[model samples]
Target: MVLLYDWSDKHKEGVTLMNSPVHASDLPDNQFDIGIVGAGMVGSALACGLARANYRVVVFDRQRPPPFDPQSQPGIRVSALSLASQKMLADYGAWQYIEAMRRCPYRRLAVWEKSAPRLPLPKLGGHRGTLFNCKDIHTPELGSIVENNLTHLALHKAMESLPGITSMCPANLEDLNFSPDTATLTLTQHPPVTMKLVIGADGALSQVRKWANIDFSSDQYEQQAMVITVEYAGKQQDITWQEFTPTGPLAFLPLPDVAGKHYASLVWYNTADNIDRLMKLGESQLIGQIWQHYPDCLPAVTGIVDRGRFPLIKRHAQTYFSKRAVLVGDAAHTINPLAGQGVNLGFQDVMALVAILSRDGKPLADPGEAVHLRRYESERRPLNGQMMLAMDLFYHAFSNNHTPLKLLRYLGLNLADKLPFAKQQVLQYATGIKSPPRWLFR
Candidate 1:
């Protein structure tokens, strides 16, 4: 249970625990209107939230969502959701479904200099100043690990009964014509439709942003991330780990599964050349490399189910909001996936935008107007910028193997640990529960 503060109620404004509503009808088109592109998690969740505010919503996607089949595939398509995001999903009625199928409740996360040598080998593996425990903050769980598909499915399920929300999947976006008055989306099959606003949740390669003449700036990282699911020989843990190497960062995120049978989602980030070599290696050879370098946390690799690679890229639209169109999620910005904040940031965008438009003071019919989308941009930009800067700093800091620099990086981690409040602040910021940008506080 959580308490929601009402900025208005003076008599009993101190604290009031709130229960999330179940299913709600879709908002009527002429009443509260909006259209979201991309039926992914971010788009679907926003649709549900907007519908709950009594806003008519429409969503478009090119592909149909696969059924949530746990046995068929049991790995996160590589993503970690923050606690704040989890709460938002729960409020949107997505948590129950996702938690049931693919949530790994992680209570503790440890990060340290694995390359550092100690007097004794055990001491080297000892808990250094870089550990985060949820119990310390009186929280039941630090964060929940979720699969991208599961989250989307859960959101789709929530939007089922929403009256004003229409989801058109397997539909192609042929054209986007936006003006000061209305945003019209021309579909290949369906009749040309118009809405007050058109969202660009399409992805890194956003068609809506392109059609709307929204320029974007981006750079591809020299390194590529290799993500795979492996069966580990250990207990199911609530720990997320990252080891900074000369090439890049490697991570092991725990997955929820049967007791004693452990599973992990592994991300091996390295230069493109090395990644090419690793990809050529058979599954056994790749697992061997993981075991060799990852000594302490090395889990015996029993199986290799799914494997994929994604070239890291950073992109941000030249403008976030214009006349009758706006961008969100990857279409707006995409940063290094090292910290796993990409999707979390997108979720924040949805929550903040929804909160502002759903407020009583906003215009009802054309909430997607310049004034409204501008408000959304003002609220999201600074926060997104801060996160992007942080990623750049971390990326550059760990990308080098200079002896002095490594020591300095270790010192910084140690200092972060010694300062309790500092550590908590970092945790709070990274996890997206608090320390939201000033505009979002409204």
Candidate 2:
């Protein structure tokens, strides 16, 4: 069942909804209020969120998403869910479905430089790295770790009963036409559908972004991420941590135990050459590497379940909107995965866009009006830019063996550990619960 809040009407609102396809002939002149291209987590969430607000939403995806299975081995593609994202999912009724499946909640986060933990320098703060505990901040958990496919499937299921949404899977976008009042989308399966707005929630290589003529800047790093899933037997942990080595950061993300077996998702970021060599290693050899390099808190890799590799890249559209369309998620920006903030940033974008479009609960003169789209762009661009820059700084400082930079970063991290209030603010920003200081964006 689906419930809605009527913004135009000042009173509390509740309404049950059903999902059905709105054919091209069902609407006046075959026009939908909104046409979203991409049914991944970001796109599906936007469709549901907008549909709940009474907007006629249409979503298209090239392939149908596979069903999420709890009985299967963990997938290599997973995401770190922040507190703000968790609240959004719960509000949108997606969290229950995700929680009903397999998920892991982590309460603590620790980050440290690999070589500086033992250096005793009082003038430069303590030797150990900074640790942020949820208990210290009065929260039950910092975030949850979930499989990427599961998140997409959960959001897709949530859209089932949303009244104003229509979706076509195994449908690919062929072309797009933009005008002042409406955008026309030509798809492979259905007749061309016209709509007031088009959303590009597609992945890094966004066709919607390309067709919209929205210029973008992309940065490809020399580093690559090697991901692996492993089964283990040990005491369960509620904390996730990353240790910065000369190559890159090697991190452990906790996963829920199944049938008395503990599991975790491992992320090893390093140069493409090194990642290639590591990827070629057999299960036992890779386990040996992990056991030798990782911190003592993690469990031994008893068995390997899955492995994958991806290159690191940073990209941001020069403009988020063009004519009657706007971009969302990786279409608008892609950041380094050093902190796993990519998807969380995308979810935050949906939140901000929904807030602007649903202002006063009254329908806008035109949902895709330049003014409204610009408003969404104005607020999100600077914030994403700030995070991108910060991550870049971390990458350069830690990836290199430069003596001065390594020392500076270690000292700064150690100092942050000592400063409670400041560290809290940083944690809040990192977890998407709050914005960073405005000056940082500037």
Most accurate candidate by lDDT: 2
Off by over 4 Å in 1: 1-32, 117-129, 258-260, 361-363, 436-442
Model 2 compared with the native: what TM-score? 0.92
- Candidate 2, lDDT over the whole model: 0.83
RMSD of 1: 10.1
Where does model 2 exceed 4 Å of error?
1-29, 117-120, 123-127
- lDDT for 334 in candidate 1 is 95
User: For model 1, how does the per-residue alpha-carbon lDDT over 1-442 read when each residue is reduced to its tens digit?
Assistant: 1011111132245433222212224222321267788878778888888888877677777654567566654654847888999999989888888878767888887777666632332322335538888865668878877778788888888887666676655556688886667888887645676888888888888888888788988988888998888887756677898877777888888876744466789899988888888778787988888777664675677877678788999988888977678888888999999888999889999988888788663436768767878888987887787778778888888888777777777777777766788778778876776775574433
Clashing pairs for model 1 are 25-163, 26-162, 26-163, 26-164
Count steric clashes of candidate 2: 1
